[model samples]
Target chain A: MNVSRRYFMILVPAAAVAWESVLAGTPEDSPNYKMQDHWWGMLIDTPKCIGCGNCVRACEAENDVPEGFFRTWVERYHVTDENMENPEVISPEGGKHGFPAAKEDEGKYFFVPKMCNHCADSPCTQVCPVGATFVSPDGVVLIDQSYCLGCAYCVQACPYGCRYINPEKHSAEKCTLCYHRITKGLTTACCENCPTGARQLVDLKNPKDPIHAFLKTHSVQVLKPQMATGAKAFYNELDGSVR
Target chain B: MAIFKDTGHLFRFAALFVVGTTSIFVLRAIVTPKSFGQYGHYRGAALKDLADRPVKYAGHQACEVCHTDIVTTKTAGKHAGVNCEACHGPLAKHADDPSNTPAKLDTAVLCVKCHAASAAKPKGFPQVQADDHSGGLACDTCHKPHDPAIAAGGAK
Candidate 1:
């Protein structure tokens, strides 16, 4: 009886510790989502954007993004004929409340909405020491908050200024391409709210997706091609002045 | 006898330390998730958690169910493919209750959201300088929200 009691004392706590670890490791449930089947991307038609700021607002509401930080934002660029290369760009409050009336009529103005490019050869993923940030099988870059060490390496690596350390979570955060919604056969909040159909969610693997035809026809270019990040956000009618 | 006595305590301490370390490793082995590194470095369970979140936007079909007349008129116009909530805002509340009327949209501001002139826009696409076009008149004065073609012609 004494031997059995001693064994029980030691074994019970060990078993309990093991069980707790198992619970901690429990993953969120996703059923019937095959990662190999989809390669997701976005096509932003710069000409179609009117800069209403609906996409920015929708992204914040959907993601619970904090103020002064942006998962997505709209930049209004005004380029004059005299200085085409030096365009004036501004995004007041991340363009959540829409833009004010243009100040100068001499310049040509257009709005460009920016977000995570979800690069295939992402610099952010490469710099994460813990692999907290990684590209998913469907071409979306995502962060695991649980595993993140709150290091800012990913933030520095992003050339487009997409990432920020989430103030509340203390983790590096950026656009997931609405991973939660897209995996379940729904479009992104930004795409859904865009009035002009300026933003479109594309599935590259799906041969029937209209992006195939659009790519064949339109002169689409990714942001910062010099970075060679394999960025998937295709911009149609991107102005030469846009950085 | 003196050496044996001192060494016995040291052996006991070493055994305890090894046992404690072994137990921790055993626990970790049992608790670690099986599908953690299946795709890349991220936990596979995160995908499921994200998928389970409630959808916010009420899609085009939901609006079409009740507002058939507006849908018919819109379908005949250029903005047919545009979802109703693009202008109406999120309809989760309005969809649940018919009495909750959505706020009226300002035509001047709303129309320019897509129609403002920009050199980056295609040459053929309809665009106007908001201040110059119609001399600061509201867009609705010249074009109807639902059927602009009929409003412009004033016949048929």
Candidate 2:
């Protein structure tokens, strides 16, 4: 007996629909589905940040971040096209006082907080031979220190140079987006303490989050978008000339 | 011939078991929360509400109500972005009793929890080895949280 190709095609889709319906109705014993597509991210408004470096201190205090190392750091961008050769980006050793004095030029200056961009297409995650580095369902990039061979592949693969191997822990380390705090339902240490609310942790899935609305209303751009790692961290008011 | 067939079946079973055991080990590595990798799974208060649903935490604003001066100084200083709760353990107890002894954000103890001394120090920051910095030095000994200036005030 020959079966019609149309009938077989219809049967496959129908069976798939039935299977999906059954799975949908069945409550998952292990709720791993809730962990999907979570990308914890930040929106830094340079115009509002005021160069106070409060976020830096707050991050240190919150996560007990050590001296001489940073989970979250700030970068001060100075644009001087008039003397293009002399134009430079100055990140005065510590970000505590924000940016150092910009030279007397018609150029512009702004403070940009830098950390793991937590790209969705994260190069750090891709280069981990031991699978120590990964992106969370919520979109934060993380390192599993125990599994980390400390091979430093993640460090090299990262174009932004965010990853570093901690010699003390004998493992790789990077900004965690305050995972311990954020998981406990607290705002990220940096976001909560931002006096001017210049920095914000946003849920891309939540339409109510002011960040979603802001992105929709404004033309915010991600850094190094050309790398096409699809960074979750977005910035507003950065001059196109700065890049 | 029957004995040979039986031996072959046993060999296949053993191979399957070995593969299964190896797979379980690999899966464990993938699923385990190793180091800061688990940070990506940070489930903020709102998301936690969707999970087990009982945990609660206070925002910095709640602390600022009573810590007005501390909060003011913190906001105006470099430490403004640092939350009162970050240094202080938890606020619920303090919120419940405003007179409760609060935690201090001072010292290398605060810094060491995260910024552990690397075998090699980065730039101007001093080496914070487990033993060297493990002793009496507080974070404030060399650096000020509110100001970038190295504190001559020393660790209190």
Top candidate by DockQ: 1
Q: What is candidate 1's CAPRI-style docking category based on DockQ?
A: acceptable
RMSD versus native structure for model 2: 12.3
- Candidate 2 stretches with Cα past 4 Å from truth are A1-34, A82-86, A101-105, A241-243, B1-58, B61-156
Q: How many residue pairs of model 2 clash at the backbone? A: 19
After TM-score superposition, the amount by which residue B15's alpha carbon in candidate 1 deviates from its true location, in angstroms, is 7.1
| lDDT of each residue in A159-221, candidate 1, tens digit only | 999999988889998998888788777789899888778999999999999999999998999
Q: Rate the local accuracy (lDDT) of all candidates.
A: 0.82, 0.64
Per-residue lDDT of candidate 2, residues A1-243 (tens digit): 787998999999999999988865633233454455455788987666555566777666655565667777777666667544443565554475454333344566666777778898998888777666677667777765546688888889988877676757767777877766566556776777665567889878776778877998877888888999989888887666544
Every model's DockQ = 0.33, 0.09
- Give the worst 10-residue stretch by lDDT in candidate 2 chain B: B41-50
TM per candidate comes to: 0.77, 0.60
